[model samples]
Target: MQTKPTKSIYWGVVRLLGNNFLMAATDEGLCYLQFHDANPAAGVDEGAWSELAKWARAQLPEPNWVEDAEKLQPYILQLEEYLKGLRTTFTLPLDLRGTTFQQSVWRVLHEIPHGETFSYSQVAQELDKSSAVRAVGTAIGANPVLIVVPCHRVVGKDGSLTGYRGGLRNKEKLLLLERAGM
Candidate 1:
């Protein structure tokens, strides 16, 4: 699929709830936030920018990247507040890029309230594509915005945690965090 070229892309690293995340932004809005680990040899890892650049290269043409941690401060702050249970909804602009179907699934995912869970089939039914439960699962798996899109709110029909790109541990923690209102 063809994608528009963006003029600027910024990268930042922030810690929340004991985990480090790489935040990427553009003039349009926040694009990606990926999990990172600290480097034992040094301090916080700076490798996230390289990873972000690689992801951008595959998604866009000749992305102009800069390490502007400050540019993503607003998003980081909001996320911190969210982790602290001080916020239930995100107000940051999302530059989510995905197929039309994926976009629809992500949009519908937002309807799932915090501390609540919906089965994949339920999400499919909500989208009026009850037969596309697997497709809904795939879309949720492909969600680019992670916590911002709230894909973790999806569960198995039996209410069991299924899959999360960021891992089940993180997913479980997020659920518990929300459930405890912490």
Candidate 2:
């Protein structure tokens, strides 16, 4: 009982304050996710956001579409727990939307695992480069899923905190949470 048949694109503009969020959902799973700061482009758009709501409906346990305002609850819990130092890993199906090269870089980020950090040069080596350290940095910068993708785990070759879209302050918070055994 589907409609005219276009790919579903669900979205949500989360008021994360210092960590504004944009969550997107698709028919098969949650896709097209990202986060930004308090910029005007970061909030939810009623019409544009409907796609994500529809997509999220498709991913719900119920087969048919229904207004399930609570689908985002679990994700909120996960994030809250993360910030409180009560959680480290996220239990969500992610949709990493990027070009092939970006996806490759993201794959490297995923392998960083939880509570561990790596260097951009190290990631370049893992990708068989040993020299594309700068390129690796750019890819990481373009990452859509922040904490979930674990880009914060990637640092400078000399073990110093590097740049983060959420800012070095938030990055420090994430790293500190992990180092504290959260």
Candidate 3:
């Protein structure tokens, strides 16, 4: 019988800009990060942990989850710096998992300069797949790493804000933060 690989994923909660976020990392590097809860009045959702587990399982058949804030501090600090408009580019290692096409789309997203917004069509064009605008949008939606990957930098062709996993409000805030730095 074949055995599935066992992977240990470290996770922790971080608070920044008055919001909570769930971050996870592997021995390889930081893998997952998402908004835990955007509204404190609604209370923190315990299900966020399970969401992390579900994502981890998708990456590795056997995922061992460990809560280690110290291990995730570097990621947290860099994120804080970015949110505070003190950092523009991320230098930390990222372990992003996705399909080949999705990876290609994400690479384009990374190329988007900080504080600059690119339309979905523009992203597709960057990949030389201008006809794959919808596919590019789907790949951007599936991005696991948020701020570091800069999916928030993608806007509508008309320059309006679009869908974001972290909520449109947070997306707007991130864009504003980046703009403020410039």
Candidate 4:
């Protein structure tokens, strides 16, 4: 049996908008981006590297992770421009890894224009599976790429804020940033 080659995942840390972020990319494209836990008063923490390794082990087969900021510079620049409210759309290639249902849900998320919000039910409807609201929420929560995927745009059906993997505070900030316009 022919074995598939293991893909190398390059990762790095970037501090932006008063928060530290962990970003990883493969030769194919960006695969992961998450907010790192850091005390605002103490600044960036060193534990984020270990967190990345743990995530890699769970997500890939014998993963090879390289710390390369230069490899992730383009993604960082775009994110910076976005957080600064200078860019509305992302052009970076994404290495989205998920089940078919999850990918479909994420595609709907991508279609949601910047500054606009969608409800979990609406996302399910977009998939032609209106009964899967809960499933849609699950997929959104599983989103690996944070701002780049724009999962923060999803809100409760009544327009209330919902859960965000990056925390509700960051979610609110993202929504406010979008509403404020570029």
Candidate 5:
């Protein structure tokens, strides 16, 4: 059976914290938060704006993409505040879509609290899925919302920093900002 394609409302792209991200909203809520330099030629391509949307769309199920920057203002402003150390928690509505297990992992990630770290095993234990430690790691790696979802808070059991899609530099900056109580 063929399922109908999901529709997407593009909230436009914005650069934040020396990185470029593409934010898109759906009727369900904010769906895509992608990291792509806006321009490789200019060397700002940590995650370019246009290329990100293409890549993000390709990764997820197809959606009828539309443009609407105004709807993205609140999220953009909140991100700016967080980067500036004036905000710690995100209140923006998120329409995160993933498999049931992935969603469960993401929800736990959200509860990790600011300025703290959790090991993959710790997260699995918290979810009472202790045997799924590796699965937990995979889910965390697949986190779509990045900082807002707090995947950067997950670390190796020994407290070593792990791989982050936004890059280790950005993760370090976030962890430092949180640790400084900024």
Candidate 6:
């Protein structure tokens, strides 16, 4: 039986950079980062604002304007601070969604540490098959969670910004933000 996709509210702040982000959860745990610039899957309703905010409030204990109190709020705040050069690292629990290989890539992305960036080729080598650079890019792109997973830190072999599902401008901004300090 095909149950219709339920409408879920994704909530987050419009960062100083003018981006709308929300850490949204499903029955499966925190599942996605809603980025305004990206084209979202149409099958899943984008959901209603007040409805989403209300739902977001219900799910998280101390929901921020971004919605949901779960660890995601502090994560966003600290990330905002970090982008402003007030923080060096992100300390928040994540609810990642993906296959084992994708999860493995995400784990590696987190440990990439603050202020450092890696090339797609380098990540592929770390994943154990140097030849999997393209696959690494795919996995990186497949990363549903941003910043927390730090996909923006991954760049092209030539140190040029590549396609960031979130928008390459966002990618460049993040890189510049990190390099500006730590």
> For every model shown, what is its TM-score relative to the native structure?
0.88, 0.71, 0.92, 0.90, 0.83, 0.70
Lowest lDDT sum, 10 consecutive residues, model 6, at 37-46
The C-alpha RMSD of each candidate to the native structure, in angstroms, is: 3.5, 6.2, 2.3, 2.7, 3.5, 7.5
* Candidate 6 lDDT score at position 31: 52
Model 2 score (lDDT): 0.69
Reference-based lDDT, each prediction: 0.83, 0.69, 0.88, 0.88, 0.78, 0.66
Candidate 1, 1-182: lDDT as tens digits: 99776668887667777877877888889888867676423533656556666668766668777878788888998999988989989999988888899999998999999888899999999999999999999999877677889998999999999999778998998899899983
Model 4 TM-score (2 dp)? 0.90
Order of all candidates by TM-score, from best down to worst? 3, 4, 1, 5, 2, 6
Residue-pair clashes per candidate, as listed?
A: 0, 5, 0, 0, 8, 0
Write the residue-wise lDDT of candidate 3 on 1-182 in tens digits: 99777788888777887878888899888999898874543544768767776777777778877878899988988998887778999999889999999999989989999989999999999988899999999999989999999999999999999999999998999999899899
Error of 3 at 17 (Å): 3.1
- TM-score, prediction 3: 0.92
**Span of ten consecutive residues with least summed lDDT in model 3:** 37-46
Off by over 4 Å in 2: 1-4, 15-19, 32-36, 39-69
Give Cα distance to truth, residue 52, candidate 2, Å: 12
lDDT tens readout by residue for model 4, 1-182: 99888879988767887877889998888889989877534533667666666666767878776878899999999999998889999999999888889899999999999999999999999999999999999999989899899999999999999999889999999999999983
Best by TM-score: 3
For model 3, how many clashes? 0
Where does model 4 exceed 4 Å of error? 1-4, 39-51
Tens digits of per-residue lDDT for model 6, 110-152? 8786767889988888889799888788899888767767898
